[model samples]
Target: MPTEYHDLSNWDIGFAALLIIVNGVISVALKLGLEKKLIVASIRTITQLSLLGFILEWIFQQNNWFYLFLIILFMTLTAGYTSSKNATRFYSGMWINSIFAVMVSSWLVTSIALLTVIRPETWKENPAQFVIPLLGMILGNTLNGISLGINYLNESLINNRGRVEMLLTLGATRWEAARDSVQSAVKSGMIPILNTMSVVGLVSLPGMMTGQILAGVPPLSAVKYQIVIMFLIASGTALGTIIAVVLGYRKLFNSDHQFLYERIQKR
Candidate 1:
């Protein structure tokens, strides 16, 4: 069994980065015009991840709950705004609603996991180690789910405006009129995670498990951690998608059984 993990040096990292040239070469050969975008993306990845590494290292060293809370809040808010931008449609205060939905879902799942499943010794005193990574994973997946959900909801409402109005005119309640769209939107958001869960270990090794294995953790232990992460992601995605879709539904309808289709504007 491998007991010690290899520590990558700067030279090793530079060598690995050279792999991006393969992509640049392909783009140039095919006249795809993606070389510039690839270069920009590579630079951004290096800069953002390097800064995040330093910030996280400092936060871990301090072990202060206030700093941790502030970091988590910032991450959640950023995720909310990012998710809102995925929608091609716009409504007033959509960003605020996205933020609230993501914040609530990610925080709830992370808190549950910390308190129950992976209660590290210094969890209460210094949760930075566990909380940061776990919340980040959940938040990332939840952002995708929320984005997909909102986009689908908006598009569905716009495309089926006539059907929705017909149902409303037929004396159906708002919920009844929008039920199909709401269900479809929620399902669309969940489909990615559901597909991932279905073929996780069989089809591909997930990032957390692969990282742990590379760091010399026992395979079984890494698998357990990966399992926990998958469950947390699933829960967070479901909650975020449901909340976002429900909120959007309410926004596009009124208690008087009227469809407020005018509020949804295509961007």
Candidate 2:
């Protein structure tokens, strides 16, 4: 098979943009009041992706470890902030906990994959290609997991406040009182990735594999890459969800086995 694929021209992209008009038309016809949001989202997607393309191109050329590190740090910080902000409820120092969870989980998984699975020849000198994309993918999924976990945990605790307090009053430890909520939150966070994994090839071809195939990669090779990506996402999501929930649990419950319900606040 040829290792080359046709490059997309500006006209091709412009034509593709026309597909958004279908969404706009639907919004107008249904009176969904989503036209403005659709326009804004479309504009942001084009602008952000374009900017990222240029920045990634430059970074790829530079091959400097420092620049790569800065980019990774910036991406991780942004992911953390976004994750925390997506939660409908708030708690004291939740942002810090979210950031810590996302950073630790995504970074750990990405590092292991890079070091062991996709070890490049110039890994120490330049690992931008593998690190950037893998970390970004992991962080993106992990962010969702963290946000979902936090939201679910908050809602569960608030809704089951009486039950939890009753358990606590019955000599239950804080962990015992909040165990159900924590487990449920973690499960909720992991649901998306789990569902995706369950129906990946049957329902749809994931973007990574599709892109690789479009770029002329052998089908089996693309499938392998996608498999690795799915595992990485799953690992990152699970780790991040567990860590964020545990941290939130600790924050909501004191060492003295008391539930500090007051610490949780509405956003």
RMSD per model, one decimal: 1.3, 1.7
TM-scores of all predicted structures: 0.96, 0.94
The per-residue C-alpha lDDT of model 1 at residue 49 equals 95
Task: For candidate 2, give the lDDT.
Answer: 0.93
Best by TM-score: 1
Candidate 1 lDDT at 153 equals: 93
Candidate 1 wrongly placed segments (more than 4 Å)? 120-122
> How close to the true structure is residue 181 of candidate 1, measured as C-alpha lDDT?
97
What are the Cα lDDT values of the candidates?
0.93, 0.93
- Candidate 1 structure, TM-score to reference: 0.96
lDDT for each residue of candidate 2 in 177-210, tens digit (9 for 90 to 100)? 9999999999999999999999999999999999
The Cα error of candidate 1 at residue 168, in Å, is 1.3
